[model samples]
Target chain A: MNEIPVGSSATIVGYTIHNAFTERLREFGLIEGTIIKLLRKAPWNGPIEVQYGHSQIVLRPDELTNIQVKRMM
Target chain B: MSDELPQNPSLIALVGSPNCGKSTIFNALTGLRQKIANFPGVTVEPKTGTVKLSGETSVTLIDLPGIYSATPKTPDEELTISVLKGTHANITQPNAAIFVVEGTNIEKSLFLYAQYAKLAVPTIVVVTMIDAIKGSGGVLDDIELERQLGVPVIGVVGHRGIGLDEIREYLECGDFQPPLLADNQVFTGKSTIEDQHLWAREVAREVARLPEMDSFTRRFDAVLLHPVVGPLVFLLVMLIFFQSIFTWATPLMDGIEAGFTGLRGYVEGIVPAGIVQSFLSKGMIAGVGAVVVFLPQIIILTLFISLLEDFGYLSRAAFLVDRIMGVFGLQGRSFVPLLGSFACAIPGIMSARIIPSEKDRLTTILIAPLMTCSARLPVYILLITAFVPNSLVWGFLSLQGFVLMGLYIIAALSGLVIGKIFKSTLFKGSKLPFLMELPPYRFPAAQNVFLTAFNRTKAFLTSAGTTILFLSIILWAMAEFPRFEAPQNASTADIERLQLEHSALGMIGTTIQPVFAPLGFDWKVTIGVLSSFAARETFVSVMGQMYSVDVSENNESLRVVLQRSITLPAALSIIAFYVYALQCMSTIAIIKRETGSWKYPAFAFAYTLLLAYGAALATYHVGLLLTS
Candidate 1:
């Protein structure tokens, strides 16, 4: 999960959304069972853009580190 | 229908997710008939417009800040949520609400709709971007959606006049019923993010037909979002943006300056000599004239920015720069506000509302003024022209232009350094998620771009007319009072000098001379710096009036007089000072308005002025050392 291949599609299994910024990610359709595909990862493990249900969003690596996802092989 | 609903011209709150085309729909609903103003005690502008209902009844529409859910994540979202909940005392609880959703992304859009439904506010869901969804081989069943949600759902292509009549017809009927779902079911459904996602997805499945891939968007993103190529492209675009501000606006600026000069000449010829003529020709015309010349630069800047925002490239640019910015502990969202600061800090600070994290938003606001705003341009150009030689380095770069670019670079570096310090010390340990959405690129609509540019230009002109006009008159009187008698056989320069020396401004300048002596500013230069506090561009006008009187010759430009009088060290010091100083009163006033506290603006002023003084002192000594 830490080094998932680029352009891989995954199903978010479980994730920890911190209290300080809750509801924002969910509002963008990033939740458990929501299928997401890594569209592009910025250089150096920086923020990456993902396709989340007909929309694309950028997420910092630090924020995504805690989110558990099962890559669809 | 509720008997308690307000009579004719009922208030309707238009809410939606960001990039859902809420503003476009607002434009569609209201046409060229909206007025934008801030909610009380805050800087978020709620655009209000009136649209005729069925026959003759017109209803007021409040276009709220875009948010994903009723739960507030940012100050702007809180404003929307509070207003809907009837807790925001500034605005009345809306009689009804128009919940706009992106039909292409119904899964996420319906989440907000469900949240709004919990309030039982008689909401109508307006599905926007229906054309884009259809183009991408997706289907949005509006009738099915209407039946499932128990609310009126109308698909609309906001830019074109699609499905607008249906919306108006619904509003005109004035028969909005509360959503069919019970409050408990709407608010308490499984009470988890996963559950909500599942619920929204199920609803979307029942409503939407099919969508496999976003082929067109992905094709563009493959090239535009490439790691190596994307950043280079973004840099090229920005270079053009910054370059145009200088090259493109020059002619328009010249035209404005010529017009002002002509007016001043006409006034001087017609008005009787003495105080009346001097005040009208020199004080009023010259002072505001200098500020007005900057109008073209501000317009060109916002015009480019609005175009970028409209075309949906700004968010992608933000994504590209986020990593570099994150290294300095600033979120990617900070990029937009910082770029906006280059045109003017007022809009820059206002746009900080987009940043989700309070800490990041605050830090961005604190450092935004450090970005060299357009107001500093007049002073910079004047100083650079007067002191810096117009020689080319390496046969490619003009020295003056390079120095101008150097000032911008220095200001930007200062913001990064300041941001780093604030991150580790003042705004510590707030780990807010940096999640940014990138909307698909589209050609910018001309009307929206023009409207944005027009609004910003109008704001600038209005401020000039009121604040700058008032300050000009006051400073003029200060320099005009306490007239002195000229000695026999005295030259016109001597008489002018004597009058200024004896005037209130001159005395104040002389008194403050010692305070700035360490920075190498003389009394005359000190007076210019002092007057600039009202508005930064006023520095040039103050200098123009102070020096124009002594020149005597009509053709001798203020640049020559400045060159002859001021030393290189002093001019450099002034330029360095302006690079960091928060001298524009409007910026401070806006900071106060946005943060809803004088403390932040006070801190902003103190820190920036300290930075300015220290930088100026260092620059003066360094220049002296190198020259000697």
Candidate 2:
């Protein structure tokens, strides 16, 4: 998921590991097959910003690394 | 469910995701009739307010911390879930719930509502920010929404108080019905999370005609969130934030100081020239005046914070700083609390409750005091004016201003460094995931901003004022007693000095003088440092009392007196000590309350004391080397 370029959309496959945090993401509508767009990445290899289901969320790179995604663009 | 009403005042819970305008709606409904409700054995305190539904009909409203789902992930979510489930010891089960949903993002909002449906509690769905949705050329079919969810739905511009009458009417009627899910199988019989999202999206599609895009938030975020421009704008915003607190508050602060001085003079004139006069003028008036003069700065700081928060810029600021904060082993959520510390540590410490991770929250609280709070401003200004030259440096900035800025930078850097150390050592753990929603910008409502600033300032005054006033009288009595007669030929200044040296506070200072001597602090300065534990600004007032000078109008006379008696190295050392010391009693008490244990506060005090002493000693020696 972190490899997706900015301004691109992708479909979530599933989480590499499921925990409370990932469960929360799922509850926020990041369920498998949901499409999410990578808005931008913070400078200095920081967190990445993404939009999923009308909600913009910022997450660290490590968090995004746990999810598998197929690029749509 | 029981058929009869539970009690006289039905308890209603307000639940929503963060940045859903839930708090604005709460403030609108409750106005000033609100108080913090603390649950037993829980650090999180949900605010409870009385909402008047109609004539002789009112309900107790609990504003729960925002959550994304019924499954608890954070302490805040745990508390909300427990209270909603009627398991929290201090709070009764809410008779009903008001589920707030953002009109602009109904699809995302409805997902949470789907999860909440399992609770089977009667709920009224409030669609807030309807104006924003309509302004962008969208429409919400409330009747369709009501039919889709099988519950009452009301649309409201919360801050503007539109569509609120219908809500009050519904509540007053006391006929709330639990959501019926007979046809909504997407949420029935242990459905998967994906099914819930599908149901919410389908319902939103039918009931909400969303605009093609939210161009307003996008246009602003283009610049505000740009990789290069975002940080620059953030820095500029911070620059303005600090500048207004210090420069803008000067005139008002001066007026307050002058008023107190005039009051002191009037009291002294009416009272007899004896212990009574001294106590009235020096003990009560001077001590309280010294602390009260900083009120303008506190108000300004709170105003800026409230405006930024209400306008939805705080979350963007947090987003911009998340990476930088990660370097210090903290996430973006720590930014707001740390920023509040610059105004005062007590509020800053309390605001650390927003951080979801326990270790991160504790570390943030432990290092919050290291930020240069406003209480340290007077001490810094007094010392800098006395010792630092006033000439311009680099042909533009004044040397004193430069030094002041340098001190602030040093304090901030030290706080970051200490935060890193604590995260690695005492609160060692893996880095937690950082997730935050970037709320869309809105024009802050004027009433909410001012009310927030007013309430915060009032809390600060009442809490810090009483402690300082009590300590001031005790310090005054110690300095006024055990008086000695002046020699026939001695001057008034000599007699005053003699009386102070013979007093109990003076004797204690003399006895402890040797311990601080290596740091270039004289007996008088030692006394000031000791008294400062009551509050940081008290050190300046203590100096004024010891020197028999009025610091209310200006510190000019006091500065001159200090320059004559204290060496340059000593002044710098004192400034260094003030910069590092955890000297405020109110802060310590608050830390104890927030952390629910004395262990952290005790460790904080001991470590800060050692750091202050060591830094003062190092600074004193450096100054001596440069001078010699």
RMSD to true structure for each model, in Å: 3.6, 3.5
**Candidate 2 clash figure, as a count:** 0
Docking class of 2: medium
- TM-score of structure candidate 1: 0.89
Model 2: lDDT to the true structure: 0.83
Instruction: Tell me each candidate's TM-score.
Output: 0.89, 0.89
Taking the tens digit of each residue's C-alpha lDDT, what string does model 1 give over B1-628? Answer: 7567634438998988888888888888887677776555765668888887766688889999888777786767888999888998788889888888876678877777776766788778889878877887778887888877887788898878799998887778765656665454554656565666677788898888656556766777787778999888988987787667766777887899889989998998889868889988878897788567667776877788789888888888888888989889898778877876886777677667667677888999999999998779878987897888999999989999999999999999998899989988999887446778888777777777877777666755664345556656777788779878878897756676678777888899899899999999988889888878867887876677677553334323888888888899988999999999899766775676567677898999999999999999999999999999
Clashing pairs in 1: none
The sequence of per-residue lDDT tens digits that candidate 2 reaches over residues B423-442 is: 88998864336778877788
List of chain B TM-scores, one per candidate: 0.87, 0.87
Q: Count the backbone clashes (under 3 Å) in each candidate.
A: 0, 0
Interface RMSD values, listed in order for every candidate: 2.0, 2.1
